[model samples]
Structures are given as C-alpha cells and as structure tokens.
Target: MIDEKEHGDVMEIDKELMTKIYDLRRRLHSIPEASMHEMQTKAVLMSFLRENTDLEIVDRGAWFYAVLKSSDDRIGDEERTPIAFRADMDAVCGQDGKPGHYCGHDGHSSILCGAAAWLSRASQNQIINRGVYFIFQPGEEIGAGARLCRDLIIEKNIGEIYGLHNIPGYPRNHVLTIDGTFACASTGLEIHMIGTASHAAYPEAGKNPGPALARLLLEIEELTEEYNRSRGFVRMTLIGMDIGNANYGVAASEGTLRMTVRAEREKVFAGYVDEIKQIAQNTADDGGFTLDIQEIERFPATENHAVNVDKLRKCAADQNIVVTELAEPMRWSEDFGYYLQETKGAFFGVGDGEDHAQLHTAGFEFPDEIIETAVKMFVGLALM
Candidate 1:
C-alpha cells in the first residue's frame, strides 16, 4: 500500500500536464491508422514521449516500448524484474470505409502516455522503486499486435503486465475486473467448398456444392449447441456466406462460409475449433467436394492472475476509484491474452460513461474524462 503522501502524489495531475495529455489524445484521435500499419501513429507517440520525458525509447518496427529505470541502486532480482503497462495504438475501419478511432484505442494510448509522464516525474523524485515499461502496440483490432509484441516480456524479464479497455455502458471512472478469463478466446473460421460446375439445364452433369454447404451449416449449428450444453459459454456467429456467381447457365460449384467462434476456456476453445474442422471435413467427404479451412484473427482467452487482480483492486481503492467486479467475462477477444500466457498480469476496464455509445459503432468516440482516472490506477499499480 502507498503511504498518504505517496497516494496524494500518485493521484495528483498537474493542470498543464493534463492539458498536454488531452491534446495528445486528440492528436492521436485525429490520425487513426489500421492495425500492423501504424507508422504515423507510432511517430506521434514517440514524439510525445521524447518531448515530455527523458526515457529510453526502443522502436520495435510495428510497436515500441519506453523504459524508465529506477533510481535505486539495489541489484536484487526483484528490482531487476520490471512491470509493464500497455496500450493499443491501432484504430478500426469506420462505416465510411476509412480507419477511425471507433474502439477507443486512441484514448487507451493516451492514458498510457499519461502514466508515462507521471512515472517519469515520480522516478525523478525517487518515489518509484522498480523499473517501468510503457508499451504502445499496434494491430489490436485484428488480433495481430500482441502476438508480434509479447516477446518483449520474455526478453526484458518483465514481472507483471497490465492493460485496460474503456467500457461504454458503465459509470465513468469505475474500475472493472474479473478473477479469470476477463475476455473470451475467439477465432475466425473460413471454410471453402469446391465442386465441379454443371450446366444449369442438366444439373446432374456435375457436382454442386449447395447440398454440402447446407449440410455443413446444420452440422455447425448442432456442434455449437452441443458445446454450449456441456462445455462453458460457446458462441458461433455466421458472419457471411457466398455461393458461386450470377451466371444463369452455370451451376454453382463453389461456396464459402465465414464465422467467428468463441469460448471461455482455452482448451475448450481449441476443442471446439477441432470439432468444427472435423465436421467440415466430413461434410466435404460425404459430398465429394474439396475442403479448405483457415483460421484467422485467433486470440486466446485473457485470463487474469489472481494476485494481479488483487493488486488492481487495491490500487483502485487507494485512488478512491469505484471497483466493480464483473459478473461474467466479456465475449469480445483481446490479443493481450498472449502476454498473460507468457507472464503473470491482469487486463481490466475503465468505464467511459453510463450512456456512452458502444465501441466500434459509427457514433462511438472515446471519452477524454477517464484519462486521469486510468493514469492514477496505473501509477498506483506501479507503486505497489
């Protein structure tokens, strides 16, 4: 626990600093970039850190991390192991067919930068005892960022990592957490069925994939029901389906089915995916159609370490922030799960507002008010 004076320092946000951070958030909000393609987004973050703080910034191609070493001279192992705070920098494509900050990533990045500014000042005053790293990642919208960046945790011997997302429906500034499986494990499954084309007049001349596709959909519906009954929460949504072209003379010989599968447990998630593949294979074999299956945007369940969750709760309490226990894990998936697999950590949520627009919608915009609240929690965790 932090002492009274330390708590005060941790929660204090200078007016000028707040203004700077807010401006930075707006700047990041203006130039939203796509996942894994955040060249311009990275430049803005790097420039902010370079201008405001004297930390070592390491550029890792698509992502980057900035480090503030402790002033303490202690050479112990615990001191060497650093804690990391992460923020995603990439944005999602809006309804306009252009990239925008629909998922509040711009605000998440700004909060991390605010924490960085605070940590730098605290380190100079010898308030921070251990090293801290600020990781700004890209490609989170498509589940590719954290996989490419999680290697840094192992390389630096990072002891604990934490990340947060803004929840739209909750009261603003409420800190939300769960003991395990904060977010569901999910992946996109694409199945392609190919058969010989036949003349429309004589459909029996060649094989059509329509029958196979219908069978596959039924089998998938059954599989989903079976899993949901025995296993934990399992959900499958049919995103799209397409059959062969508009040629009137030709029989449809090819079909594609795209879906997203999600489960609460990683093992169950894998089992569900395997069963799906087997079902697709069997349907293809029965209909004598060639089958092709691909999994995209794969994400493991974001399971939080109990100890880290406790730390987050305590930190929120210290900051006088409302701590809300989540009743169930979120259905959405986050690539931050990759980091938790390699190290002990927690991913949490900060409330945006009670009636704020939902994330990824056309009207969604990140609330700037929560930046101070999030930064204080991060600083408290660092002190702990």
Candidate 2:
C-alpha cells in the first residue's frame, strides 16, 4: 500500500503542470492523424518529452517509448521487475469523414506524458525502486499498433502493463476496472461473390449472386443465434452490402457482403469466423460463383489479469479516486490485448462524465479534468 506522504506527493498537480498538460492535449487534438500515419503526432510528443523531461526516448518508426530508470541501491530483487503504461496516439474519423480526435486519444497521450513528467520529478527526491516504460503507440484506431508494440514487453521482460480509455456516460474522473475480459474480441468479415453478368431480360442466361448473398445473410443470422445460445455473448452486424450497380440492362453478377463479428472469448470468435467462411463457400458453390473472404481490423479480447486488477484498485484507492467495477465486458475492442497476451496487465477506463458527448462523434472532445486523476493513478501504480 502507498503511504499517505507518497500519495500526497504523487497527487500534487500544480498550476503550471496542469496548464502544460492541457496545452499538450489541445495541440494533439488540433493535429489529429489517422492510424499508421501519426508522424506529426509522434514528433510533437517526442519534442515535449525532450523539452520537459530528461528521460531517454527511443523512436521505433511507427511507435515510441520513453524510459525512466531507477538506481536505488536499497531496492529489493522482487521489486525490480519493470512495468509499462501505454497510450494510443491514433485518431478516428469524425462525422465529417476526416480524421479527428473523436475518441479522446489526445487526452490519453497527454495523461501519459503528464505521468512521465511527474515521474521525472519524483525520481529526483525519491528513490524509485523499479523502472517504468511509457509507450506512445500508433495505429490503435485500426487495431495494428499494440501488435507491433507488444514486442517491447517481451524484450524488456516487463512484469505488468496498464492502459486506459476515456469513456463517456459515466461520472467524470471515475476509474473503471474489471477482473476478466475488459473488452470484446472483434473483426470485420467481408465476403465477395463473383459471377458472369448477362442481359437482364434473360436472367437465367447469367449467374446472379443476389440469391446466394441473401441466403448467406440468413445463414449468418442462424449462426449468430446458435453461438449466442451455446457459447458466451456473440454478435454479428451487417455493416454494408453491394450487389452490383443500377445498370438496368445488365444482370447483377457480383456482390460483396461486409459485417463485423464480435465475441467475449477468442475461441468462440475464431469458431464463428470459420463457420462464416464455410457458409460463404457453400453458398458460392451452390450459386455457381467464386467466393472470397477477408478479415480486417482484427482485435483480440482485452483480458485483464486478476492480480493486476487488484493492484489497479489499490492504486486508485491510494490516490483517493473512485473506482467502479464493470458489470460486463465492453462491446468494443482494444488492441492492448496484444500486450496482456505476453505479460500480466489490465486495461481500464476513465469516466468522462454522463453528459459528455459520446466517442467517435463530431462534437466529442476530451475533458481536461481527468488528466490529474489518470496521472495520479498511473504514478501510484508505478510506485506500487
């Protein structure tokens, strides 16, 4: 447990530090970049670290990490395992169809930076026993960032990792944690059927994939229901479908069906995907069309370790932050699951107030008030 003096020291956020952190968030918000294209965003964060802290920054092209080394001789061997905190640096498109900070990634990155600054200050007067890594990851919006960055955990031999997402519809500054699966596993499945086109007047002269596509939809619905009943929570949503264009003279010959599939467990998720592919293949064969299936934007379930959840709860309690235990796993997915697969860690949420604009909306902007709360929690976790 963190003592009162240590808690007080970590919780003290002066006026200047708060202003700097807020400014950094605003700067990041203004210059939003899409997944795998956060070059400018990376530059700004690296510049801030160089200007504000003395920690070593290692650039890994798409992502980067800042290190805080501890050199206390009194540190015990058990307490020397390194820990890591991650903040995604990618943004999603707003309603205007352009990239923007509609998911509060700016706030997440800024909070990590704030914790880095505080850790730098704390190390000067206090003896930090273990090293900490601050990972500024990219491509989270497309579910590719953590897959690339999880290597750091293996390379550094990190004992635990932590990440947080700002969630609206809850009271601001409330820290949210779950013991098991924190987020669901999800992926995009696209089925394409190709056949020969002929004159619409003689429909039987050509092969039309419309019937096969419609039948495939029904089969998918049945599969979803079966999985939901037998397995845990499972879902499938038809995102889009295009069965040829409106050329009146030509018969519809090719089509594409796109849907997102999600499940609470990885095994169930994979089984559903395999079943979907088989169904599509059978439908294409019966309809006399070539079939192709592709998976995109894949994300594994963000399963939190039970022990790490306890540590996070304890840290929140030490920092005097209210923590809400989540009743169920979030329907959305997070790439941070890649890290937890390799190490022990927890992915949590910070409430952005009940009245705040929902994420991925045009009017959504990250609330600056939660910066201190997140920073204190992260710092306390590091010290723990």
Candidate 3:
C-alpha cells in the first residue's frame, strides 16, 4: 500500500499531462513490439512511471504494477483491497512485417500509464476510498498475458477492476458501459487431416486426404450457418484453413483446420463445439480421412459485473462524458475476460479514431485526443 498521507482530492491531470501522454503514446506506437516480447516497452514504461509518480511500484519484469494508497485513515484495513486497471502492452505477430498498431495496444498502455499518473496526483489531497493498482501486462497479442496477470491480481486481492481498449467507430468522449456482450467467447482448435503417402503420378495406389479435407471445410460452413440460424444468437467461424501434406506427390495425408467458435453464453459455446465435432468427424470418416484434433478454450465470454456496470455509468455521468449504452455485445474476444471471471471488474472500449479500420490492421495508430479524458474518468472513480 502507498503512504495514505500522500493520497486524495489533490489528483488532477491537466493539458500539460495530456501532452506528455500523447507523446508517449506515439513513441510506443512506432516501436510496435509483439506480445510477451515487450522488453523495450517495459523499460520505457517503468522509466515513465518512476519519473512521473511517487507511488509504490512493483515490477515483475514482464508484468509490473503500481499502487496508490488511499489517504483515508478511518477506513478499515480489510476494505483496502486495491482497485485494478489493466493494459496489455504488446503487438500482434504474423502480420505483413510492417510493424502495425492494429489493436491499439500501444494506445492502451499509454492510457493506463497516464491513469497511473492521474491517480498518483489524486492521492495528494483527499483520501481515496480504495487503493489503486496499475497493471501493465505483456504478450496480450497471443492472449496469454491476462492469464498471467490474473494470478498476480488475485495474490494482491484486488477488490474491483477496470480496463479499457480503443474501439473502431466510437467517437472521442463517448464512454460506454456495456451491461452484456461487452466481449465474446472463443476457443481455438487445430485439426490435422491425415492420409497415406504415395507418388502424385501413382495417386491410385495411395489414399488421398485432399477430398476428405475439402469436404470437411465445406460442411463446417454449412453446419455453422445452420447453428447460427437455429440459435439466432451465437456465431461460429472457421478462421483458418490449411490442408495437404507438404509434399506434392504423397497423396497428401496431413491437413489442419484452425477455427474459433463464438457465443454469448457457455451453453451456446458447448452446443456449437459438440455439433461441429460430430459433423466434422462424420464427414472425415466418409471421406476416408484420419483426423487428429485439439481444441483449446481461447477466451471465455466477458460479462460485466452488474454493480460495476452501474457504478461506471454513474462514474461517466459524474465526469460529464457522453454515454452510449450498448444495444449489442461485441463479438471480439479479450483476455481481460479472464480477469472478470475471477473478480468483480469491468472492461470498456474508448472511441476508435476517425475512419479507423478494424483492429489488427496495419493502418492503425493510437489517437492522442482521448488520453486525458480516460485518465480523468478513472481518477473520478478512484477518488470517489
């Protein structure tokens, strides 16, 4: 816990602070390191956090945290569980080698850092009711960092959590409180279709897996469309397709299908997977194809805590920011969904820049305009 005497109503982040944050945001954008490989990112962030604030800092190398203790002396120690704010600090891989900011993780880190500065500043005058935890995690591009941060957050016994991402199409100053479908559920599966090896010229001597694999892909789409229509809610997608043996001649034995199944509920997720597997297996069997399959839960559906959703709505109103209550939940997946699984926390997206392409595209950059707004908003919640 940070020294409480240093906390309170004194927290304020003005224009000059916003400038520093904007510069830092672009600087990180230009570097564009992928997830779990954010060493330079960690260095720059640690330097900034140390230079800008007097908060107690905890560095776990890949994942670091900073805590600002509340100034209230009358508050019981048990109620002092810190409020956590998380930002993933990594870029996506397997891109066009252009070093893109497709997901605005670069922006996410900068905002969280700025929020830390604001909280530190707020700790100066009046006592905040709960401590603040600033979490900067690495390797979120592959969706592994949040699970790693989840343990640390639990170890610290954080009371409530909040997280943010920059979204496409939303305007600046719009604060969203997504009550449901804030994010979607997904699982990654890798399927290998196998066949016997034979010379391409002598294909008749060997069993070919190509026809079987092709049938599987076609059937998957049909089955998914059927499921989507039946439920009228869930959506399934085959995100990847690779088939045939590396060799041209050997009656290509090994093929792989990588896909994600998304749904609003676990039951929907279960139904999607069970049906897909059965259809695929039956298709492969008829085609004389051998199958080696592995499906891993990639991210669970992120449901906002009811009270948190309400509190942040009030928090936005208190900050005088425009609120857009979502009519539909997002279909994208976030590892932060893991944190919400373990604690009462909320993750919301900030505005996407003008003409913004969807995340993971090379043509993306962090917008500097909203930096101060986010910091001030979190500061409002912290000091309340």
Candidate 4:
C-alpha cells in the first residue's frame, strides 16, 4: 500500500497493476492513429476490456465505452448518481513527419483503463454505490469526438461526467480546474472568391479581386479589435491566402482566404462568424466577384458546472493531491466542451511537469510517473 500520509489521497495503489498500465501505454504509443481512424487502437482496447474486465462494451462506429452498471438491488435505493469518465483516444501528427502520441492521449487512455480495471475488480465487493461509464473517444484532435458520442451520453442518463488533459508546463501531479469556461471556442473559416479571367495585357476586361481581398483582410482585422474590446475574448487569425494560378499571362480569376476565429463563449464566436460573413459578402459584391464560404473544424469552449468544480476539488483533496483553481479559461479549444453541453461536468488538467516537453512536439513523451496519481484521482471521484 502506498502511504496516505506521504501521497495524500492515494492510499492503496497497486504497484504491480500500475506497471501493467504503463506497459499498456507503451503499446498504445507505438501504434498512433489520427482522429477518427483509430481502428487498430480500438481493437486493442476492445481486447483488453474483453479479457480483463466485466464491464459491458457499448460500441459506436468511431467511438466506444465500457459501462459498469450497478446491481439492480442497489439501484435507486442508493442516492448516488451515475458518474462518467472520458478519455480521448486519438493521436496527432507530430513534428517527426509521422503520427505519434505526442499529446499524451496514450497516457490519458491508460489512466482511464487503469481506473476501469480497478472498478471492475472492486465491483464484486460492492465498493461502488452507482453506475460508472468509461468513455473512449476518437477525433478529439479534430474536435468532433464528443459530439459524435453525444447521443450515448444522453441515452445513458449520465448524471455527471469528467475528463482531464495533461499539461506540460505546470508542477507535476497538480490538478487544475476552473469554475466557468476551461477552454475557448474556435472554428475555421474559408472564403473563396471567383471572377472572370482575361489576358493580363488587357486586365481591365477581367474582374480582378485582389484589391477586394486586401480590403477584406484589413477590415477583418479591424472588426476583430471591436469584438475583442467588447467580448474580451475574441481573436481572429488569418491563416492563409491564395489567388489565381502560377501562370503569369492571365489576370487572376479566383482567390481564397482562410482564417481561424476563437472566443471564450459560443455566443461571441457566433457573433464573429456573422460579422465575417457580412463582410465577405459585401466585399465580393463591391469587387464584382462571386463568393463561397465554408466552415471547418469547430470546438466549443469547455465550460465547467460550478458544482462539478467543487466536487473535483474535494476529490483531489481526498487523494492528498494539490488542486489549482485556474484564474481564467485557457485560450485553446477542446471537443470535450461538447460533453459539458450534454451533461453536468468539468474537464480538468493534470500537470505533467514544468520542464516537460510541450504537447504535439516530436520531443514530447507522456511521463509514467503521473499514471498512479491519475488513476487514484478518477477512482476517488467514483467513490465520492
């Protein structure tokens, strides 16, 4: 047994079992799959759950979860609400020119698995008073994972849900959470402009939208200032711009503008989108160009329920783990926000270490040292 006095809330972590979880993380690390393409990874997870746990597997096309139902005899008699835990199972393309688990998703999945294994082992003893669901989500990097599983959450009547990401720049093992938004909402916008092409020697014969594109870019920046001043969290970034073909003999007939917009709230992001569309349409008309706009990959801000935040803090304290109340929501976006929209919960963060390599970088690796801490934290919450 790990001493509770030294480690705080972690009273009895199984060392041998934890070693197995670390090995599982290594296996997952070796077979990194991106976004919705997690077939092989899914197979591995399925096999592990089948052979080692008694939980029922609920498989959707791109995502799956293990559900541990409470015994019927103890159902509503117990006042405890059903709790859910989520772990993202997709990897990201890293700087090494290959797909890898640089975001520590491998660790996250293993932590959930470890907690599930313990719950399964302890269920026979009736340690848990209510049902528990362990959700393995895909496409979290592309911001669609939780949305895809939204139905499952609703069907199961999950009373509460929780998730965590490993943060590399904070003190190791510290748990960080916020009361309101935990991350920002963001979406990509693509604007395409089309015009009649003609010979460069007779450029006046063709409608050139170069000037219009320039004006729109400038106007978009100015609009961003207004939104940021009023909303306090809006930001727009011009990612790329393209016009015409490589051939120099013809006046450019087409152009494209790509940008990303983000804000702390969905309302603010919607406001940004509406204004962008208005500006694009006006500019296209003024320049005599036809326009097409496309919205790409979107993630809402991860907002935490106030009660969930308190629960997380109490759980961390029970595990003798330190908890940090974040002053503001992170500017980055997460699809985990979708879960919060469906149920009451909080998506917290666990510190990897102040000196650990940053996420999505080739040099980054998930540290094994924090695995037990993560497992204990989740298990503690379920017990609560």
Off by over 4 Å in 3: 1-12, 73-80, 198-205, 229-232, 245-250, 278-289, 295-297
Give the number of the best model, judged by TM-score.
Answer: 1
Per-model TM-score, in order, reads: 0.96, 0.95, 0.86, 0.94
The 0-to-1 C-alpha lDDT of every candidate, in the order given, reads 0.90, 0.90, 0.75, 0.87
Residue 281 lDDT (model 2): 95
Ranking by TM-score: 1, 2, 4, 3
lDDT (tens digit, per residue) of candidate 2 on 256-297: 999999998878888988999999998999888999899999
Task: Give me the overall lDDT of model 3.
Answer: 0.75
Tens-place lDDT digits, model 3, residues 1-384: 122333222334566777888888888877878667788888888888999888888888788888887677634476566788888888876446544667888778888888888667656755466778888988766668888888866787787888887877877668866886588777777777776767888987766666776677788778778767776467756777775646765566566787777887656777777787887788678777787778764777777888888878777776567777777888887878788878888877777654667677666666677776677667666655
Question: Could you give candidate 4's per-residue lDDT for residues 217-277 as a string of tens digits?
Answer: 9999999999878877788888999988888999999999999989888778878889999
The backbone clash count of each candidate, in order, is 0, 0, 13, 3
Candidate 4: how large is its RMSD? 2.4
Local error of candidate 4 at residue 195 (angstroms): 1.0
Which portions of model 4 show Cα errors greater than 4 Å? Answer: 1-9, 72-79, 95-97
**Model 2: clashing residue pairs?**
none
